[model samples]
Target: MTTSAELLAAYDRQLRTDAETPSALDVEQLGPLRLVTFDGGRGFITYAGLDGADAGTIAGWVAGALGYFRNNPAIRHIEWKSRGHDWAPGLHVALVGNGFEPEESESIMIGRAADLAVDVPLPVGVALRQVTEEEDVRAMSAMADGVFGDPVSTATADSLLRRLSHADGMELWVAECGAEIVSAGRLEPVTGTDFAGIWGGATLQAWRGRGIYRALTAARARSALAMGKTLIHSDSTPYSRPILERSGFVKVSTTTPYIWRAPA
Candidate 1:
């Protein structure tokens, strides 16, 4: 059994680069930050750590990072990805002062793919399948956004469609109850690494506690194994943390996304 510390170390070393941003349109470096631009006018900020920088230095970095995106007219939204274990000083205050809002934090869960590949029975009248078509992808994205209380956004669906067109080993899985999607998630196999990420896991409120998510996770784990991935990772919300923990995943760390939107 790999400990949480070991798993987190491995995650930082192997899964934090282009593997994490396969769809990035451009990536620029600002000191320790990887300033990435995605297709939907989105900017992302991520870094391994602050390298023992002081609060004043980190504040300067924050201002410079915001300036980098502010100069780009096409960029409307920016997300600064922060880890609980990082050595960032005064980062939260800086982000908040710069008009960034903190979203919910999630547990960074990791475990062997084989440990999560067990057989989980789906609910009666429910079926699971990989979705690709535009309609199905839209339906999946809508269900996911609704479950998370986000307004329906076509940009998300459009991005997923673009990724699907590339056939980049990213699989979208959905558990359907009759004609409606009850649960949905994505399986992203990292190129040049032994890991696969299970992201965007969402289950309809009424469908909770019925093993549909576990079954969906198992299905994805099986798919990851087929792709020759040995490790599985996820930034799991409170709703799905226990389920993954029960399935042999350990909480390696925590992650929070601070979001900033350009002034209208």
Candidate 2:
């Protein structure tokens, strides 16, 4: 059994390499900031967990990354993801000075995959499985959008379509009540690494407290174990943090996303 620290260490080691990017708009280095391109008209910036930097350097990085995005008309917005454990100086001020606004912060949770594999009770008739078909993938993405309080986005659906084509051991799992998806998440078994990322977990408000999310998490864990992954990590919202803690995941740090929205 891998400890949470060991699990997180493995994740950090792999994320900087194999898990960093998969497309043109993924993760790019512009001086100090890690520039990322998402499916929509958005770009993003994150660091490799830098511990500390002076205010001047931090400010320069923010300005430089913003300049890069401004030069590219393809990017309409950017999000700077900051880790709570990082000791970088003046990050908050720098982001704001350059027009980035802080959004809600989330807990960075990590744990051993086996910890979540314990048998969990599920609502009768609810089942889970990996999705591959285009229509089903689109439906799941739409359900997730609804759960996340975002409007339906064709870009998300299109990206999922492309992701399925590559396969690459990435699998989308959903908890279905009858024919409707009540909860959905993704399993990313990073190649040549001992970690698998459990991402985008969203359960409908009405479905809360029913253990559907845990069951879905377990299903992903079981799959990860089969694929030789020993660890699981997620940047969790407050709503999901307690549930994950009960299931043995520990809060290692917090992450705050700062956004620069293009003028509408």
Candidate 3:
């Protein structure tokens, strides 16, 4: 039996670097932090467990990470992705004291691909499929943004399109009801690892409880299994965590994203 500690250990070892920054154009290292510059002026800050760093050392890293990104004029939006199980107890104060606002925390869900690959009955009139065309990709992004209450992001769609063009093992799946996308998610197979992640899962309010999202998850899991991935991972919101939990996924940890936006 795989324990939560072991699962989190694998995640911290295998997923904290390249697996976390697939779209990064440049990455700067500040102490233990990886300050990443992605396309479209987005910056991201993350790291593996802080190890044994004390509050003062952790505080210095926080300040240095901010300065590293703010110096780049193209960096308009920054996010510090913090894990719940890390030993950096002073991260919250250091980040908030430095003007970063914390977003809602999400559970770090980990499970076996076979557990979630089992058949899940979809609702009548709903069909799931992988999308690659520009029109379909754009529509899926729009529906997911609306479901998550975020402004529609064309940059996200563009990134996905670029990945598809590169033949990157990233799959976007959507559940459609009469030509309208009601639920959507992404499956990314990490090269050289046993893990493939299901990310950005969302469902329309009216479509909730109809099994569309669960069916979409199973479809993604089946796709992951076909890609030779035996493990599944996700950072899922509360709305989606229960569904994943029901399918035998366990919460290995939690993650909270603290965000900073440049002033107009």
Candidate 4:
């Protein structure tokens, strides 16, 4: 029975920093922000907490942060990750003023891995397994993109393949019906932490309510436990938040990503 406050404290102290960006190609510090450059021309902005900055100061940071990324011609898109619990004033105004558009906020769910490692009955003809081959990884990414209603992009697949080369303890799992991937997600085991993150979970619309997602989650939780991880965390969308809540995950906080795209 971990309180939300305790889970959130662990999330901020243990899960933030470079551990949150294991695949980053470059990381630069901008005041209190971590300006991360990743492959596929992506930039990311994240910080553990804003040290009680006023509105005007945050606005200046916003402008300066965007300027830092704008200098890199290779960077075409950026995402600023904001947590609901932070005490930064005028963050919304500052981000929007700098051309960042808000995306949907997700529940920051956290709980013990053992709680989610229980057996979930899978539908017949569907199976879950960890994947590693290049072909399998690409297929899993494409399927997840399609399930999430995004036009499939090779950049996403390419990034995953590159991460695989690092052997970064990232495990890809999928639920397949014969040859088609119906559900998919990835488990990221952070170094020097007691937490494992279940991320990028998505399932086909037709496969909804079939318990496939739960089974897939359970499988990842079991893998986390096997890796000696004590806690499981996910930034869950509305579609998956309920499922996690049903499994005893507490909503410790919320997170929203404000994205900016360079003009083509």
Candidate 5:
């Protein structure tokens, strides 16, 4: 078994991809930060190590990055990726000082696709399918927002619409009970890489431990294997971490998302 540090490095490497789509394989350099763009209008800022930076320099970097994003209105939102292990002094404060709000930190989980492909039992009357219609996608996104306790935003649905326009290999899946969406997630098969990412795994609070999320994960893993992807990666929250661990995912690293929202 690899150590946690080694696992984290591997996870980061898998996530940092470079593809025209939402692939994490590519990294573009914009001044001191690496500019990573995904399928949606999502931008990511990452750096190797932030050592020897005093408050003034850190604040300057923050302001510069924000200014760049402000100039680029095409980019809807950005996430400043932070590593707790690197001990970047005052980095979080700098980000906050520049209109970036911190969101819940997650552990980077990686595992073999085969390990997660086992048959998972789902609750009765539950079924999973890929959503392609605009109305169905919008309804699914709204239900997912409600399940995750987030305000229903057209942002997610709009992003999905754009993704549908491209109609690449990205897929969105959900578990439905009767006429309602109980659980939802996405499967991303990254071209030019051996990894596929499972994202937005959320289940309602009332249906916590009935294995719906795991079942949905397995269904996606099966799709990934069918697509010839060997590795799986996800930034998992505490709510879904233990279930992922049980399904053979290892805690490789942790990710803290610092977001820059439009001025209120």
Candidate 6:
């Protein structure tokens, strides 16, 4: 049994780079940051750590990184992912000063896949399965966007389609009642590692507290285990954190994304 500390340390050391950016169009190293350009004009910044740089050095890195994206007209949106356990200094102030807005913080949760592989009962008439068809994928993405209170985005659906075309070991799962998708998430098995990620979990507001999401999670975990993945990890929002905690996941750390959008 791997302890939480050991798992987290491994997560920080091994699973931080291209593992998180399977579909990235390009990846560049900017000092201690990885500047990744994804499709749909989005940019992502992540790194293992700052390597003990001081506040002033970190601020300079922030400015230069933002500037690199700002100068690229195609990069419309940028996300700088910051972790709670990092030794970052003045990062918040620097990001805000560079016009990046902070989004909600989420817990970085990790645990063994077997721990989350327990059977969870679904509501009567609800069925869970993996989805692959374009129509099904678009429907699942729309339901997730609605649950997250974001406008329906064809770009997101298109991105998923592209990922699927690559056969990247990513599986999309949905729980449907009759013809409507009520809950959904994705299982992404990282290559060259023993970990898989459960991401994009969402359940309709009217369908909350019905254990559908848990069932969806368990389905993904089972798929991961079958693929020989031993570790399961997710960046969980408040709504899903308690459920994961009950399923034996530990709060390894916290992550917050600072966003910047280019002027139109």
Error of 5 at 215 (Å): 0.3
Write the residue-wise lDDT of candidate 4 on 224-253 in tens digits. Answer: 999999999999999999999998899999
TM-score of each: 0.98, 0.91, 0.96, 0.98, 0.87, 0.98
lDDT of model 4, residue 50: 78
TM-score ranking, best first = 4, 1, 6, 3, 2, 5
Clashing pairs in 3: none
Model with the higher lDDT, candidate 3 or 6: 6
For model 6, the superposed segments whose C-alpha errors exceed 4 Å read none
Q: How many clashes (backbone N, Cα, C below 3 Å) per candidate?
A: 0, 1, 0, 0, 6, 0
Q: Relative to the true structure, how large is the alpha-carbon lDDT of every model?
A: 0.93, 0.81, 0.90, 0.93, 0.79, 0.93
lDDT of 6 at 160: 95
lDDT of 2 by residue, 1-264 (tens): 346566556556676552645543466676656788776677877666654678898888889889988887878878887877677888899899999999889988888888898778988888887888988899899999999889998899898788777766778999998999999999888777677888889898888899999889999999999999887778898888887898788877788989998888
lDDT of 5 by residue, 1-264 (tens): 346666667655555535323644345665456767665567778876555677778788778777776776667788898866665677888998888999998987888899999998888899988888988888889988998788998988988877777766888998999888888998988877778889988788888789988999999999999999988888889988897898778887678989987654
RMSD of each: 0.9, 2.1, 1.2, 0.9, 3.0, 1.0
lDDT of 5: 0.79
Model 3 over residues 2-120: C-alpha lDDT tens digits?
Answer: 89999998898889978888767998888778889987888999987687899999999999888888899998899999988888968899999888999999999999999998788
| Candidate 3 runs further than 4 Å off | none
Instruction: After superposing candidate 1 on the true structure, give the runs of residues whose Cα lies further than 4 Å from its correct spot.
Output: none
